[model samples]
Target: MAAVLLIESAMKFAIAVFSAAHAPSSRRALLFAQAALAGGHEIVRLFFYQDGVYNASDAVVTPQDETDLPKQWRTFITEQNLDGVVCIAAALRRGVLNTEEAGRYQRDAVAVSAPWELSGLGQLHDAVQDADRLICFGGA
Candidate 1:
């Protein structure tokens, strides 16, 4: 029916990330992502640029009760099949890439995840291009 179709259509939405790995911002984003997935809305893509790449790190040894920003994002994206991409330029600039990047650059202890790919500005541009609407949060 038309009503069902309209409801289904309303479920698809996009969200962007440019926030640091802080409790409030990260927790807010996790809640939003969870809501979108529960509502049957497509995340479209989560672009982690600037300080936001920390949200995609694989080894954040925070307390159990503390907000696990990386795990929350990883789990939500994997569970919901969201496209999560981390900007390579920003990741490197801000120290969030993986062992490969660390070895390549002779750095130490990179902390990114394989589920979240390293990307460039073009990827973000493309994501925004395909999304019905682009919504960015925590970008200064």
Candidate 2:
């Protein structure tokens, strides 16, 4: 029936995160993402904005007793082959840079790597246009 088809349909989600990796917001976002995927929903993209850029930074070191949310994010994104984008302006301001960005800015270090992309807001806009739902977490 149409109702059963509708109930079984999978949605495409765009997740926007605006908190640091150690923050509860980021953890909640991660859990939501996991649940969404497990429920057969597709993640169109993961957008990291403001402090959320820290979730994609390779330079972020977690305390020994704490969960490494950033690392977990990286692993999940890579394993899922998901598009994970970090806002370039926010990331640069927060000292999180990919190799290309580091080279462009003449920085000697790179704080971000593969599976995480440094891009502008356009990517988020595109994801919003393509996704059926836009879930946001941790913003002022």
Candidate 3:
């Protein structure tokens, strides 16, 4: 009799965060992203929508006694070289902008930069198409 072998395949995932930076949902999403990468899974994109755009904002300041989830997210995205996108409309509404956006809006400063791209819903749609699964955290 021949022995059978079983192998698990790595899955491609698209993560969508819809919670604020200080929210528990965002933290869970970050942890999930880390675990997914450690498990040898691929993260196609990290989409920040609605309140989640705050996580991509450089202006977000963490309390001295609290965890800086935004900074952690930025570091993770930078180190892993992942596609981190924030919804332009949502970001604009929330006052989070990149250099280009800031200039376009005649703003004095840029709230988002490297490792965080300000784009549209199309990016999330594209990521979903390329990923095997779409994991979303925090939404009403």
Tell me the spans in candidate 1 whose CA falls farther than 4 Å from its real position: 1-8
In candidate 2, which residue pairs get closer than 3 Å at backbone N, Cα or C atoms, i.e. clash? none
TM-score of 3: 0.93
The sequence of per-residue lDDT tens digits that candidate 1 reaches over residues 16-133 is 7788777476667778878766665666788877778878887667688877778778887787677888889898987887778889999878787667888788888888877777
Cα lDDT tens digits for candidate 2, 1-140 = 76577558989999999999989999999999999998778999999999999999888888999999999999999999999999999999998998898899999889999999999999999999999999999988
Deviation from native of the Cα of residue 79 in model 2, angstroms: 0.7
Quick one: RMSD of model 3?
3.1
Model 3's number of clashes is 0
lDDT scores in order: 0.77, 0.94, 0.93
Ten contiguous residues with the weakest lDDT in model 1 = 6-15
Give residue 10's error in model 2 in angstroms.
1.5
lDDT of 1: 0.77
**Model 3: per-residue Cα lDDT over 3-58, one tens digit each:** 22211567899999999999999999999999999877899999999999999988
Regarding lDDT, does 1 or 2 come out ahead?
Answer: 2
Q: What lDDT score goes with residue 96 in model 1?
A: 83
